[model samples]
Target: MRGSLGRRELLKGTAGSVALGLTTGARGSVSAAPEAERRRAVVIGSGFGGSITASRLARAGVPVLVLERGIRWPTGPNAETFPHMFSPDRRASWLTPRPVLTGSPPTVWRPYTGVLERVRGVGMDILCGSGVGGGSLVYHGMTIQPSAEHFTRSMPAGLDYERFDRDYYRRVESVLRPNGIPDDLLHAPEYRAVKQFHDHVAREGMAPYRVPLPIDWDFARRELRGEMKPSYTTGDVLYGVNNGGKRTVDVTYLAEAEATGRVEVATLHLVRDIARDSSGRWVVRADHITTDGTVRERKRIVTDALFLGAGSAGTTRLLVKAREKELIPDLPEAVGSNWGNNGDRIFSWTPLGDSPGALQGGPACMGVRDWDNPDGPVTVVHGPVPFPVDLGTTSVIGFGIVRPRGEFRYDPHRDDAVLHWSRSYDAELTDRIRERIRNIVGGSLADHLTNITLDTSAFDTTTFHPLGGATIGEVCDAHGRVLGQRGLYITDGALIPGSTGACNPSMTIAALAERNMDEIVAREVGKVF
Candidate 1:
């Protein structure tokens, strides 16, 4: 069988994919059953949840094995690993044979597996990421934390808002080092779009409105000076940033985990199932996929403890099937319930007259928080499309206090989780986003929506932030421990009972992971340590 994590390629020029900003670790590639791995803890899916948990576990001297389904994104000497947004190559998708298009027309585009992974649910078309860094590889590096009041509706009752706001948020910031684009750069010619929205929000008297991101400031400056190629300004985040401009988890958390000499990160290890053996230990079944999307071997890994950090869609699908097959029959009734799309509305405005519209300016740099009514809440963040749209196209993405919840139940015929949803579930949020656009750009020709694109399925929209399934106070305990199963925990966005109230959920996911690890370490692995 072929190697799993691409360790064999480390000696070649492709090693940068696995260890982006790390200083240590043997950094072995994934091998299919080269030998059985027995760890104190086995963490599945290396996104925000798995990355932070593995880092904490390794630091505490617990042996950890992190299984990531996608292959490594090795940056060549010229940063060739990450393809440009307009010209996405094989590295862009998770397992598709080509770059799959989700937004607007040109429905069936190219044919190459790149970073953005498309999971076609029965009622929805889900977009997720693959690779060692997981979602971090493809998402905009925004770290917007929701106000404590926004956390009232969902999540565990009587949560310690003080601890989360002060301690956990700071913990995430300490690692991510997010900062607002300097005010000096705000009015610069290259940052016109960023400056434009900043002024709009400021003039509209929006509360706590600003763009905070984890982009490399110096790298952006170089790119602005034409010394570097397009990273953020030219739609770099849409695919994956080829330059060292975006600081994702692989460079930060996973690197720290490897430095401890107690963690082994194995990419291409797609976790498939979980079952309890005779001795009550956990047995994890997985597919060790190669770089070419070939399954080299089916590996069954045994561990003392297991974590379901794959993500909302990923973890929910796995657990729901496991329950139906009686692998973990004691799973709770809320296993596949309380899921949402963050009330997302993906609409764009292309001005009527011929004017050089703004193109991609890296990650989302500004947001408007004016529409948050205690009665009905919503937050709209203005983002750029950065490309052929330069002639006028711009993205209008919104996150509302949407409470419409959907559920995922295993479909025997399809052998996948089918989401129960409808077009009417998003009508309220969509109308709110339209009003936000009108208010923010009232005088501009963009006040009225033009060149709109709708999901053909049900005129439904898409969202990168899919939250809840096996959530806290429901599927898992307040501390993220699954009720029916001990040693099996969830520490991802799946644990967030609802939307993050107009802000991006990455920081909250990381902070909650930090909070959960504090509990998991003290209780579950203290004896082993």
Candidate 2:
């Protein structure tokens, strides 16, 4: 069952606590302290990969500094930033107010293109969070490991996934503390809707699965106080979850990194470019935006170690910008190409008579994985809806399609990405998947059912799950080290050269970051200074 409090009410209830924790004396000391020693590694973009890198590096006794382009989003009354997507000014900015680009890359770039071609083109939303925690602040917090098939087929050679996953994936999961919904919550009426749909698929002989959420079990229990409120009931996570049900990097790795006193985060500071010095160290140029919106150019403290975790857009932009300026020459031909957003589509179903709750809240928890066949296109359902379950009045189910290798081109003329994605060649496969969904929903509800088809047109603008621009193998080597560049690394979604079949990208990104950092620590720690 849903909680007594409306979404707004839940925000009001949790706002005070988040504010007290996120914005207090925690960050004051860094701003007040004098310039510290130069044994530091400057990290660009504080999203999941960057945050995890900073934390792990700091724990290893390396002084780490994180530079973020967006302001430190506070979980205050203005936490209204969480639901800005449904706001009247939906088209005002490319992303939420906090500087996190939640929409997928292609969808976000579509308006700039002015041409919409569905066939032969794949549409993916590359959603990325900004601010101190990066995407962790806004992600659905679904922590999933990439399947073995992904590593064997998608990952580049020389990269051993067997060793990497065994050594580093667990560490990443431990830091994030992903949790599964209790059986009781899963059986709740809101969840039942999703389960019913899954059952229908199973009856039809499809492979369906449950979503693994990154919620801290104990913390969530305490917050609920024995009540039946869904964890996702308070804030709209697709924008940003201010009440902390989602375990963004700020609350996870970055927070722990800060406690060690070896890490510092500078929000609202955008990294423009990076260059290696004559001594082989790296110098990063950045633009720092003040609270009043003033932009000032600042040079980051020089370091021999640099990590770039600024999602696909930010990371690609920086690398491309740097290449254009000759900061690093002899760049690879594939530096800014082969990008893909998990081909995604949303489908909404209206259930019969007043369902227990609405669809306003609930982690994307159930899905079907029929996309694993090499002979056929793979498909996976993350989960079903739970709260705000009034199908006629308020509910919808969203499914993500993982599309492989669409082309990405950089347009220096427009200072934007020109992407061409198409699935026309796969029409038969696409139709088959669509039919599967139609049949399942039809079989489950019988008489009282209203189905809504959501093409790319339904949303005023589309959002993204992952975007890869400065992709791996093309832009950087196997270990995230950019080609023709020393002391620089790329460690975000941009490094994902292709899709991971049916899985969420966050845990995969985090695991890769951990693996990359381990390599850096083993080889470069003493050389940084």
lDDT by residue for model 2 over 145-231, one digit each (tens)?
656765555555567777767877788767767766676655555455555655656776776666677774443344345443334
Query: Each model's C-alpha lDDT?
Result: 0.68, 0.55
lDDT of 2 at 368: 61
Per-residue lDDT of candidate 1, residues 1-529 (tens digit): 2222222222121222221100011123544343445667999888999999999999888989998876677542237677666656666665555565554233233333356766655556567777788788878777887776776654457568789988999988988899877765555666666666666566656653566787767776777778767666655567677777667898889989999999988876766566665566677766565565555665667787899888888888877766765656578988888887766677664544423255556577777765447545666666766674565655656777666377887765554566666657667766766766666655445544433333222344456777888988888888888996768889898887557766678888899999999998887786532
User: Each model's RMSD to truth, in Å?
Assistant: 7.5, 11.6
Against the true structure, candidate 2 reaches a TM-score of 0.76
Worst 10 residues of 2 by lDDT: 16-25
Top-scoring candidate (lDDT): 1
Q: After superposition, how far is residue 204 of candidate 2 from its true place, in Å?
A: 3.5
Q: For model 2, state the Cα shift of residue 457 in Å.
A: 6.7
How much is 162 displaced in model 1, in angstroms?
Answer: 0.8
Off by over 4 Å in 1: 1-37, 74-78, 103-113, 203-208, 353-358, 371-375, 443-460
